[model samples]
Target: MYAIIGATGHIGNRVTDILLNKGEKVRVIGRDAARLQQYVNRGAVPAVGDLKDTAFLTTAFQGATAVFAMIPPSYTASTFRAYQDVVGISIATAILDVGVTHVVNLSSQGAELPRGTGPIVGLHDQEERLDVLRGVNVLHLRPTYFMENLLANVPVIHDYGYAGSAVRGDIKFAMIATADIAERVAAHLLARDFSGSSHEDLLGQRDLSLQEAFTIIGRRIGISDLVYRQIPYDEFEQALLGTGMSRDVCRLFVEMSEALNRGLFAVNRPRNAATTTPTSIEQFAEVFAEVYRGAQHRHAA
Candidate 1:
């Protein structure tokens, strides 16, 4: 049996879908029973509970041959790192207690750095804690910047005819689709080819700059003049804070952008065939345009 945390989320949902299609028994763990109903109907055992509750996670993880784990994003947390640590520690403890033999952890590319990587520091901590488990084989899947993150700019694109961020328009880096990440995770969970604790970096089809990304998106959406502006760090932070993000999360996001601009994420990491995926910017642009049009129609209604 496979146990999946964050089962209703983008990555988890795809993971569960693939597993169920392959005729594997799946147990899904999430906080909302209503959201998990679809998976339950499809033959997954639903385990609804808080991630921080060790007892809940222990019970959910029990009797599973392997598990997919992640710390769900919490924008409302008073302190981002503290919240990540609590969730991370709880997951590690439960995996150990339940004696699950294999685990695939969702991590980020910058998790190799000890500090200055903002929210990714928490993932680094998770890797370290989970690595010490004696009987468990852990594989940390480190994916680059998610292309879906562009969805956050939909409102700004609609209102201002542009998208903006603290990142410079010219800095090129690997960006991946969450679907691709899910594919790799499901493959690993099924094969169990990896032993001991290790990590693999999932870089998308190619590297791209924010300007190039926006150009592709604009072309797809029929906006010939759409622009991507690099907002000042302070202004970006203020905007996120205004959106109800806690101070710590706002600061961490800014730090993460700064780190990306500095080329910190790619340090010592070289892209190879193993890290490259199949999705391209043009492919994802179509998906983005579809979502943008849906949002536009909803607003017009």
Candidate 2:
């Protein structure tokens, strides 16, 4: 049996579907039973409860051969690291209690550094916490910038005619599609071949800058010249706060952006076929275009 935490999430949902389609028994874990109903219809056992509760997670992890784990994102936590520890610690403790032997942890690239990487620091600590388990085999997926992240900028581009973020416009980073991440994850969970604690870098097809990314998106959305602007650090933080993010989380995001600008998120291994995945920004532009049109329709409505 496979246990998937955050089962309705981007990566987790895909992993669940892949396993279920292959006739594997899956226990889908999430906070909302309603959101997990679709998976339940497909024969997954629903384990609905708070990720912050160790007892709840211990129950969820019991009877599973392997587990896919992650700490869901939080925008309003007053103290971001504290919130991470609440969830991360619970996951670790439950794994210890239940003796689930295989775990696939969703982490970020800059997690190599213990600090200065904002939310990624939490992932760094979570990796260590999971690694200490005596009998568990852990695989930490350190993926690069997600293409789905640019979905957040669609409204801005639709309203203001330009795409922007805290990232430096010229700095290139590997951009991945969540589907590709899920594909890698499903393969590992199905094969169960990896032993001991280790990690793999999923750095999409290649590196791309925000400028290049916006240009591809522009073509798909029918814009001739879509510029990607680098928002000033203070302005970006203020905008995030205005969107109801907590001051602590906003500060962590700013620190991560600064770290990205300095090229701090580095890969220890050389790029090769094993580390690379198939999705490209050009293909992802189709998804972006669809979202942009929906945004336009919403404004008109």
Candidate 3:
């Protein structure tokens, strides 16, 4: 049996679906009862409880062979560090208590960086806690910036004929679709093999510049005027704050963008079969283009 924490989320949902399709007995853990029920209806054993609840995780982890673990997002916290510290401790301790044989942790690139590396520092701490486990085989799956992140910019691009971010418009960086991450993770889970504590750097396809990405989107969407604009970090923070995000959360995002600017998210590992995803940006756009078009339609409506 496989247990997936944060199962209602985007990547988590894809992982659950893939596992179920493979005829695996899957258990899903989620905070929302209604969302958990949706997974239950899909043939997964639904466990409704907060991931911070050790008793809950302990129960969910029981009878599970391997588990997919992810730290749930906490955007409203006054201090994301404090929340990460507390939640990281809870998750690590709970996973250890459950005695699962293998754990596939969803981690970010540059997580190996030590303290004072800003956003990567928090991920480093999570890995530190997981590293102490002697019995469980833990694999840290570090994926680059997700392509789904571009979906958020669709609104700005459609409405204003451009996409904006604090990132350098011309800086080429590695980016992967979330489904590709799910594929790599699901393959690792199904293999049921343990190589002790290891790290898998998932570099999806080649590096792409935001400016180049805009050109591709423009060609497909028939909007040659589409542009990718570089914004100031302070302006980005203010925009996030305006969205009701906590200052600390906004700061982490800004620092992460700075880290990206430093090329901290690039992968150096040799590409392998596992890292190869069949989907490309063109394919993704072809399928999900309606979402962007729908956004445009909604604005016109």
Candidate 4:
């Protein structure tokens, strides 16, 4: 049996679906029992509890062959790094205690760096903590910027008629669909081909500029004049702060964007066919249009 953390989330949900379809026994873990009910109905065993509780996680992870681990973001934490440490330690300790033979962790592209990568620094710490587990094979799946992140700009597009971010819209970087990440995770968990602690980079089909991505989205949504704008870092930070995000989180987000704009995300690691996934910006735009239209319809109602 495979235990999946954050099973109600985008990547975890897809992983659960793929595994269950193949007749694999899946135990879906999440904080909300209601969120996990659908997976329960779909043949997955629901294991609902707070991830920060080691006892809860240890019990949930017991009797599982492999566990899919990820630290869900806590944007409102008073100290984000400390929160990540607590959760990471809990997961690592539980995996060791349960003697789970394999683990697949959802990490990010810049997780190799020890510092200066903002929120990614937490993921780096998680990787280091998990590395200390004896006899457990861990695979850190480091995926690039998620295309779904662009959905955060939906309100900006609706209100200001443009998509905006602190990073330059002209800079090209890998943007992956969450479904692709799930597919790879399912493949790795099912195959169990990897042993020892290792990492893999999941870049999308190709590098794409934000302007190029927005153009595709615009065409799909039938908004001929829609554009992508590069917001100033201070303005972006303030905007996030106004949205009730913690000050540290706001600063970290801007720093991450700055790092992206400076080409820090892809530094030293060149993309190849193995890293490139199949999903394209054009294909993701169709999904974006559906969401956009749904939001529009809700507003109209």
Candidate 5:
């Protein structure tokens, strides 16, 4: 059996769906029983509890051959660093106690870097903690910026006519679709194959400037004059608030954006020919229009 923690989340849901469609038995862990009921209806066995609870995770990991592990950001904390420490400890302890053999962790690219590594530094700590596990094999799937990030700005795109960020208009940064990430995770978990302590950089077809991405969005949504504004770092708090994110989360996002502008988010050492899986931003946009947007509408209703 394959287990997915945070199964109700965006990437987790996608992972469960893919695994189930392939006739894999999936155990989905979630804190909210009500929320988990949706997955139960879809043939996923719901394991309900907090991921921070090692006992809960131990039970959830029972009979699972491989697990998809991830830590969701807790912006309610005073700082991102604190949140990272808490999340890292929780996930690492669970992995150690669960006795699961293979783990596919959701991490950000550039997380392996040392101090001053920006928002990804916490993810760095998680990878480090897992490295000490004695027998289990771990795969750190470090993906670039998620396509779902744009969905948070749907209101801004529709009403305000623009997508704003601190990134340069032509920075040509990598972006990956969450569905692609989920697909890769499902593939690895099903095979029970671990290629040692490897990190997979899930890159999109190519790098795209914020301006260029917005242009594609404009064409797809039938808004020719759509724009991407490069806002100042200090203003990101307010700007993100305008987009409906909490103030604390917005501040962390500002830190991430500033880091991105400084090139902290760019991928280095492209994957070798042996393990490259590239998805184009344009192809991802089509799915955004079809799958994710429709899901969003249903959620809103």
Candidate 6:
């Protein structure tokens, strides 16, 4: 059986759907049974429990041949890195305890760096935690900036008529669709071809600056004058806090933006067919438009 942690998440949900459609035996682990109910109805065995609980995770992973794992975001985490460490340790410990043979772990582009990349440093630590294990094969999938991150700008655009962040608007970086990440994870889990731990970079279709991305998003959403602004770091952190994120995680986000502005999160590998995926920003703009329109309608209502 194949097990998927974060089964209710963007990448995990897509991975589960793909595997289940292929008639694979899937054990979907998630915190919300209501959210996982759809997968359960579709023939997935649900392991509903807390991610930081090693026993729960061990139980969830016990019989699966391969597992897809990630450290899910915790917006309200009082100490963000501590929360990440707990979740990461639980996952690694569970894998060791259960003797799961294959693992596809979700890591980030800046994960190679041990510090100064904010929450990404947690991923680096997690990679280290798993790297020491002797028997199980692991593949760390390091994906670049997510296109869906743009969705976070929806409220800002609606309220202020502009898009902005602490990261530089002029810097071009790989922006990938999370769907593409899911495809790579699912393919690896199904193939199970590698014998040792390795890492792969998913660089998306190409690189585009935030300004360039916003232009495409503007055209699709009928906002021809839309532009991306570089908000001051303090302002960005405050905005994040206004969204109910704890100050600790908000600070980490600001640190991540500083790292991004310094080019720390840029694609680390050459642009090759293997690193590049099929989804384009133009295609993702359609998804952006639908979301933008939905937010618009909700505001109007």
- In terms of lDDT, the best-performing candidate is 1
* Model 2: per-residue Cα lDDT over 53-79, one tens digit each: 899999999998999989999899999
Q: After superposition, how far is residue 85 of candidate 1 from its true place, in Å?
A: 0.7
Task: Tell me the tens digit of each residue's lDDT in model 6 across 232-284.
Answer: 99999999999999999999999999999888886345789999999999999
Residue 290 in candidate 5 has what lDDT?
63
Model 2 residue 252 CA deviation in Å = 0.8
Full ranking by lDDT: 1, 6, 4, 2, 3, 5
lDDT of 4 by residue, 107-202 (tens): 999999898889999999999988888999999999999999999988888888999999899998889999999999999999998899999999
Give the clashing residue pairs of candidate 4, or none. none
- Candidate 3 ranges beyond 4 A from true positions: 115-118, 267-274
Clashing pairs in 6: none
Local distance difference test, per candidate? 0.94, 0.91, 0.81, 0.92, 0.76, 0.93
Predicted structure 1, TM vs. truth: 0.98
Model 6 weakest lDDT span, ten residues long? 262-271
Off by over 4 Å in 4: 267-269
lDDT against true structure, model 2: 0.91
Model 1 regions more than 4 Å off: 266-269
Give residue 111's error in model 5 in angstroms.
Answer: 0.6
- The parts of candidate 6 lying over 4 Å away from their true place are 267-269
Compute the lDDT for candidate 1.
0.94
State the lDDT at 269 in candidate 4. Answer: 58
